[model samples]
Target chain A: MADLRINLAGISSPNPFWLASAPPTNTGYQVQRAFEAGWGGAVWKTLGDPIINTSSRFAAVHFNGQRVAGFNNIELITDRPLEVNLKEIAETKKRFPNHAVVVSLMVEPKREKWHEIVKRVEAVGVDGLELNFGCPHGMAERGMGSASGQQPDLVEAQTMWVKEAAQTPVIVKLTPNITDITMTAIAAARGGADAISLINTINSLAGVDLDSWNTIPHVGGKGAHGGYCGPAVKPIALNMVAECARSPHIHIPISGIGGISNWKDAAEFMLMGATGVQICTAAMHHGFRIVEDMIDGLNNYLDDKGLASVSELIGKSVPRYSDWGDLDLNYQVVARIHEDNCIVCNKCHIACEDTSHQCIERLETSDGRSYLKVREEDCVGCNLCAIVCPVEDAITMVEIPSTELPMSWNQRQKAIGSMGQNEAPGAKEAV
Target chain B: MSDYGLFQEEKNRLDAYISRQFKIVGITENLSGATVELEHPGGGQAEVRLLTAEGRKYMSNLVIKQFTAAN
Candidate 1:
């Protein structure tokens, strides 16, 4: 067994896994069951002035059979009465004393409204507060969600107001719609946010319905771009986390969100210096019971790698990440496609030819059958084609021998730069 | 089976099978050569090699398995 407990801002959890503020934590009953099932905490769904929630509120896209690759929603902040949500939070906290229960809040952009929400939530025995400034859909249109986050100054001022209003720790959930994440992060840190979490989701149109020529989740036969989250957003979320971690002015702990579906995804977030990983889409796609796999997977990974504690693995790989110049110039690879067992699908060829470098070739058989092949010279070894290919044991990127090719781009750039400087046509310039 | 013997057998089987699949100037194991050059069936050259010990182990184990591209 590995030590999975983590202490963030003086609040400790049995594990760093917290249910993101979503439908799973929409009520105390839902959250209590989540804790019993081994979740470390639950950020009770975003609470605001009670409003009407429409029927048919969500739209989704599926990928690779069982996974929800992307998710969108017209859903607004918590529609349940504030007092009812508060009562549930208080009771759940009383029962699961060890688990963290942070309440997610969204309110009008006023000092009085925010101050009142903070005071009321803290009295319910929550360990912390995550200001819901990141919801990019319905609430944003109302000037309460991402609209507040898009302006850095407003994010700063609102966070400070909450800090003054609440005695417990406060986390600012940031929107991904911003061009620069560091600006918002720095603003939150300046405003006294104990931590920062992202990214609420990106505004996106999942797809359009061709029959009525209308878009999906059509409210009155029209659809707006809703916040996109799921496995698809992991890379974008990861880059933002690293940016915030690397920023000198923003040193607060980051609660990584967006598309974390498994322990490996969670570990990747932690390695990028996230204090904890918050998840929604994975839970929404599968169920809260998936947390068990997350717990066991993380524990087994820690044990197998000889890591004594979860903390030891946090941000362990951040130092190895660096700029392009930091990469070893000598490293190289070539794409390999095994011929005998090839299933003759042209996915690899289409991916390489259409999207990536013109590297893959398709060969025809005597019986008019054709299979995909990789061209050596053009293949930059990006592995995008291989990653997209569905067949197992199909395509692999093998490292090129160092002596086979001299520093390719390196020597070429050097040669091109010294063309005019050289005394003779092919004369070598002194270093 | 010993690792060396296993590597030798797998390498020999792959060399023979690939030789028959694509028309090429026959395959040879030049352990003395430092480079791994792969000649594509489509008149292109790839000068890449499996460098690390871990990579060689993975390649040896999976070399003989069948492969296919997805549509």
Candidate 2:
């Protein structure tokens, strides 16, 4: 088996799968259960001063029979007293000595409060600390969670304070609610954060019940926007991870968290520069046992790829991610229909004729048999025909000769501007 | 206008076919000849260089046939 173990910013884990700080990691018992289920680590739910929570603190949206495609939560950090959470953290660490137990912490923005919390959590022998700069709903209003996370300066100052008092490595968890997440990531690095975990949930109103006109998971017939997570947020989370991975300004280990459901999802995040990926909704939906497949599958994937370990997969695809202008505009592909595989439902034909470019032609052969063919010259390679085709493997996109050479828009502009000529040539010189 | 004509007989059919099939962006007439700019179906602009009588006759016939037959 390929080595699945990972040492992220000095905090080592048996594997790269960690339970995100959520309901799944709410207590020592829950975390111990997770370790038993084969998770390498768990960031115990955010711990701080106790607070009263609403009765219905969670709401979820489902799509195509998938439970909680997007999950929303109004739940605050751990409601248990700080001492209780601290004691549990110690107990959990003692029980799972090899497993990573990073304490998630949130406290007043004051320097002393952060210092005090960091010291207490570190004293428990936890592997590391993740600054809960991200709970985006009820906690931000109190200027404790996302309020500080949204501001880079605040993230820097708070992280600095925690780092000053903490013995363990600090992982600054970031909020997705911010305009540019990198700003806060860079700030955390400046403040001496050992690692970064993202993205904390997005601010969302789950949905309103049309009949009752009430927000979902209504707290006493009323509702507030909560933090959104789960499957629907994976694309957003992946994009953020890729951006951070590509940027040289922020150099820190990333613990990717948002809508990761399986080992494939974990691999994508890892390839995009996350050292480990913390998961919540899947564990919430499928229980902690899901990590069994996550661990085995990742090991199989690494072995199949001829890689030695999970660290080898990290940031492997970062070089391929780039701006739109950097993409090769001259690269072209056209749709090709397979006569043998085509079901000929006329879906692709009709779609191309009415909605997209009218490039498909239904031709009658010499034997009075009719079949659809693409007018390649007019195809545009838009894939509209392929998209509307019901049959799999019926239509395939084939690369064709391009009008331009291998050059991007950015390169084209540079070539034009370098000659000290104001007026650039037309089509003749574009390539 | 007829002095340098190549396919004077097919001009009307080609014009009707090209105009009905594609959107004409602009036509520029330089000292050499005319360049008819037409919007490509996918995106961007495709220029038909009618700089010479032969060039005009050849390109117009090819594009007109391609568009009209596809329809």
Candidate 3:
């Protein structure tokens, strides 16, 4: 396998995959097990002055047959005492020197509090510090988390304050609930953050229990919107990461987060300009062992693609993305169905007849028999019916264009026709 | 609505060239929207239908299905 080692601002890791600061990284025990399982690094769960957590702090959304999505907590940062967390950081760093152990912090929005936290954490041999300026729920009500990140001036001031007191590298994690990600990223950069990580979950209200007239994960029959993360947020995270990477003002190192479940996802974040990829939901969903696949898959993919190093793939796709209207206008494809395999279900027929292009043609035999037919001119190439069909490979999309004329296999064979029906593949039946 | 009107209004435009392009009989086709169905010359049936609501327009993309009888 090709080399997967990466160095972000002098903090090196065996690979670019790191655990995001969430439940999985809430303690040193969890983090050590994660490293032993092959994760290259981890951001210790957000730590600050101890705070209370509610008993039932979660909700979910289901789609199709899966619990497709969810939300988290009335919980605050790591509830463990600061000294205990510090002692673990020192031990974790001493035990695994190669892995990146960046301490994530959030406290009262005071420069003195940030200054003290950075100084104390730096002494633990930690590789870096991530400002937890993006937690959207309980913490924000106290003028921390999203409160600090939302105001550009506060983002800059708080980042600058920590940078001033820190010896270790500082990364500012941004919230997705903001208006423009670029504006916040620029603010972080201007404050001298060594790098930026994003996004901390989006604000969400999971769902409602209509009879009780209360929101889910309800406490006292009422619930507030919580921060949303998991697979559902990956696209939004990717878009924000891309915006930061492409933004002219901020070109610092990036640790991408949001719904990264496997190596392919980590690789996409790298290609979009993140030097490292941080994951939370996946680790929560499948347990820490997933890092084994993440490491193996990325390494194998690199070897197959002939890339000798992880850095080779970083930000590679950034240049290909451009403003809208620059896309090619002539590309086209047609919808084609396999005849011998069709089940003759008329669901597509009824759907198309009443609601769509009215492009379907039903025909009867010369003896007054009937079947379905397609009017090619009106078919717009939507693959919806294909998705709803139960048969496998029965329907497929085939591309055709106005510029290219049609070709008939029978006509070509007829033009070269000298062979009688007696010797062909179906000749016996014809006779 | 008349099923025959739907078929003729949909297929009349493609009558001249479709048989040459795809070796199939035009069964029911709607070019204006997602409701179109066709049978390939090889005897497979294809159908198109609408699935979701479209924004800023009267239609969204069509769902196309192909089928053959199961034994």
Candidate 4:
């Protein structure tokens, strides 16, 4: 078996999968159960001043027949007492001596409050501390959670305070509910954070009950915005991770969260620059046993790829991801319909005719059989026809080799700008 | 006419000037299209407007080629 062990910054885990500091990691019992069920590590839920939580605090967006395509929650940090959580953290760490036990913390933005919490949490012999500046709901209203996290200055100051007292590695979990997540990431780096994790969650509302004219998961007939996570937010989370990973300033091990559901998702995050991945929504949907499949699938994938260790996947694709202006303008692809595999459904023809460039044409064969063919010259290769085709191999987009030299939009513009205002020859003067 | 046909017509026009020993002197691009200026050594000059994406790309390639040859 390929070595699945990973050491993110200074926190070593048997595998790269750690349970995110969410509802799943709310208690020692749950976190211990997760570790027993094959989770490599767990970040205990955010600890600070305990508060009461509402009954209707969770909602899910079911896309088509898929249950919990996206999960949203207005839930606050650990409602249990600070002593109770600390005792459990100490006990859990003692029980699973080999497993990574990182404690997540959130409190008022005071320097003393941050220092005290960091010292208290580290005293329990935890592997690391994740500063929870990313819970985006009830706590944000009190100027905690995403409130202080939104301001780069506040994020930096709180991280500095925590670092002053923290003996263990400190990870600053970043909130995505901002214009740019890299701003907070850079701030955390400046504050001497040992590592960083993203993205906490995006501000979202699940949906509304059209019949009752009330919001989904409305408590006492009222609702507030919640933090969104789960499979549907994978693209958004992946992009943010990529953005931070590719940045030059924010150089820290990333504990990627937000919509990581399975081993494939974990591998993608790792490839995009996450040193490790944290799971919550998937475990919430299908219990803690899901980590078994994740572990098995990841091991099999690593072995098949001829890699001896899972850590080899980290930041492998970062060099391939780039800005749009760097793309070659002369590179082209066109839709090609395979007659043998086609079902003659005319979906491709209709999609091309109505929406995309009019390229795919219906033609009657010599034997009077109807078929679709793409006009290679006019087909812009938008992939609309291939997307709408019901049969998988019916339509394929093939690259057309360009005879001309490659030129990007940036290069073309630069060349044009260098020419600088040349008047057309033989043009009439203003007369 | 199809977009390809318009691009072919513009490409032919550009090639015709080159065949007549005309060298590209200037190019002006605006919302309308790209206007290419060409001058022959015998003191004759001509201008052509290219309105298609392919035609503009073709014009750019020629300009780059001219730059490479000069340098």
Candidate 5:
């Protein structure tokens, strides 16, 4: 079997999968059960001043027939007392000595409070500490979670305070509510964070009850915005991870979170620069046993890829991700319909004729049967026709080799600027 | 006519100028399209407006080739 073990900035785990600091890691019992079920690590739920939670604190966005395609929560940090949580952490560590147990912390942004909490949590013999700067709903109202997280200076100061007393590696879990995530990531690194994790859920509301005219998961007939997570937010989260991963200033191991459901998502995050992945929504929807399939699938994938360790996947695709200006403008792909695989469904033709460039033409064959063909010269290769095709391999995007030298938009602009006076002969008359 | 036909017509116009020993002097691009200024050694000048993407790409290729050859 390929080695699945990973060490994220010195916090070693049996595998790259860790339970995010969410409801699943709220208690030692749940975390112990998760570890027993084959999770490599767990970031214990954010522990600080205990706060009472409401009854209807959770809601889900179910897309089409998929259940819990996206999950939203207004749930706050651990409601249990600090002593109780600390005792559980110490006990859990003693039990799962080899498993990684990182405690997430959040308190008033004060130096003493940070020092005291860091010292107390580290005293429990935990493997690491994740500064929770990303709870975006209830605690944010009190200027604690996303409130402190939104400000780059606050993130840096608070992280610095935690690092002052933290013996264990400190990971600053970033909030995605900001305009640019790299701003806070760079702040965390400046504060001497050992590693960083993102993205803590985006601000979202699940939906409204059209019949009742009330919001979904309304507590006492009222609703507030919640933090959004789940498969629906994967693309957004992946882009943020890629943005931070490709940044030059932010150099820290990333513990990628947000909508990581299965092994494929985990591998994608790792390839994009996450050293380890913390998952919650999938575990919450399917229970802790889902990690079994994740572990097995990842093991099989690594072995098939001829990689000896899961760590080999980290940051492998970062070089492939670049700005739009760097992409070659000369490269082209045109849609080609395979006649054998075509289902004779007019979805591609209709999509092309109406929304896209009028390229795919509907024509009768020699036998008077209908078929579609693409006018290659006019087809812009937007991939809309292929996307709407129901049958697999019916419409394929084939790359067209260019005869000219490869050029990028940046290069093209530079070349245009090099030519001095570009004023047309009849430009004044045309204007 | 299709866009390809327009591009072919414009490409032929450019090729006609090139066959007459006309050298590209100046080029301009705007919302309308790219306009190439060609001048022959015998003191004749002509301009062609390329509206299609292929035509513009063809013009850009020529400009890049001239730039590379000059350097």
Candidate 6:
């Protein structure tokens, strides 16, 4: 069995599956129950000034036959008084000494306020601190949460204040509502953070009641846009993790968040350089029991791949994630139709004929026999034919070797620059 | 049309000499095969139904082939 244990910036856990700081980790009872259900750790829901939650705090969006594909919340951080939350954190840590207990905190972005909270939490012997700078809703209006996270300079300054007062490792939980997440990520690293977690949540209004013209998760008759999460936010979160992982400046370990719901999602994030992953919506929908399957599937996958440790998977795919300029322009592939495999489906022919390039040729023999053929020269290798083909393996994309040598746009630029004189030298000859 | 089997191998290659002899003007699908309209340098227009006995013979581009272009 592969070792699922990870030391995320000096914080130890039995596995990489941790409950994201949300309603699921709202209290000591919830955190202890999640740990009992096989979760390795929990970032206890954001703790700070107590706020009253509205009547309707959550709204979900369903598509087709699926439910809660996207979730939005008008909820604020732990509505419980801070002293009660702190006492609970201390009790939870004492009860589950083996599990990771990282407290999520968001307060006024004042130096003294951050210092006071960091000292108070670390005094309880919490494993680490996750600064919740990414909450996109309710609390943001008070000059905390995303208000402190969206600005790169504020993220850096606030992180610095926390670092000064923190005894344990500090992980800055980033907000995804920003224009460029990397700016904030690099800023956190520059502020001397121990690690980083993302993405807090996206600003969204789940939907509106057409009949009432009121926003979803409405308060009485009106509503305000809330922070969006769940499976819908996973892709956006994954991309942000990849962007940070690929950058040389942001060197801190990333705790991947957003729409992560299962082992595959966690694996993708780890491969993109996340030390571990946090889940909220999945646990919210199915309960913490889902972590059992996640742990089991991840172990099986690692052992099958012959990996000695799970940490080996982190950042494994970062080198391959690159800008479009580096891709080879000479690479080409053409579609080929298989005779035995085709189920007489003309879907591929029509797709290529009308929607895409007119590369597919339909032919008929005098004996009343007919089939299709691809004009390879005219094929742009768009894979439209393969996508539309109903039969398995009916259409295959076959690679054609580049007639010339490999030369990317980046290389072309360098070769042009080396010429010294601006004669606009042909890249094929120059290289 | 489900009458003929697709060319399964590299045999699907276009014949260089035969392809150069006539330029394909247009192709339309019908009962027997794809009706290919070709234009010769002599300003002559001819239609050949491909994926058939005669069409297969012309595609070979190797054998001593004869073509009777339908006016």
Write down the lDDT of every candidate, Cα atoms only.
0.78, 0.84, 0.75, 0.91, 0.92, 0.83
Worst 10 residues of 6 chain A by lDDT: A416-425
lDDT of 1 by residue, A1-431 (tens): 99999877766899989999988889888999899989998888899898777666788887768556888887887877889998888899999999999989999889999999999889878899999988887788888889999999999999999998889989999998989988998999999999999888899887787788877777887677788899888999998988887777887888889899999999999999888888888888788899999999999999999988898877777776765644544466878898765676778888878888777888887998777777775566788877977778787889887542233334433332332221332333322
Across residues A147-203, which tens digit of lDDT does each residue of candidate 6 receive?
Answer: 989998999999999999898999999999988899999999999899999998899
Error of 3 at B56 (Å): 18
lDDT of 5: 0.92
Q: Chain B alone: TM-score in each candidate?
A: 0.33, 0.41, 0.25, 0.92, 0.88, 0.40
> Top model by lDDT, which number?
5
Give the lowest summed-lDDT range of ten residues in model 1 chain A: A418-427
- The digit string of per-residue lDDT tens for model 3 on A356-403 reads 656656666799855556666566666655666578876777777544
Model 6 misplaced stretches (Cα beyond 4 Å):
A337-355, A358-373, A384-396, A416-431, B1-71
Scanning candidate 4 chain A in windows of ten residues, the lowest lDDT window is: A422-431
- For each candidate in turn, the TM-score is 0.76, 0.83, 0.74, 0.95, 0.95, 0.80
DockQ, computed on Cα atoms, for candidate 3? 0.03
CAPRI rating of model 1: incorrect
**Which window of 10 residues has the lowest lDDT sum in candidate 2 chain A?**
A416-425
Off by over 4 Å in 1: A64-67, A324-330, A344-378, A401-431, B1-71
Root-mean-square deviation of Cα positions for candidate 2 versus the true structure, in angstroms:
9.1
How well does candidate 1 reproduce the true complex, by DockQ? 0.02
* TM-scores of chain A, one for each prediction: 0.87, 0.93, 0.84, 0.96, 0.97, 0.91
Question: DockQ winner among the candidates?
Answer: 5
- Chain B, candidate 3: TM-score: 0.25
Shift in Å, residue A2, candidate 2? 0.6
Output DockQ, candidate 4.
Answer: 0.47
lDDT of 5 by residue, A363-419 (tens): 998999999999999988899999999999998999999988887777766776687
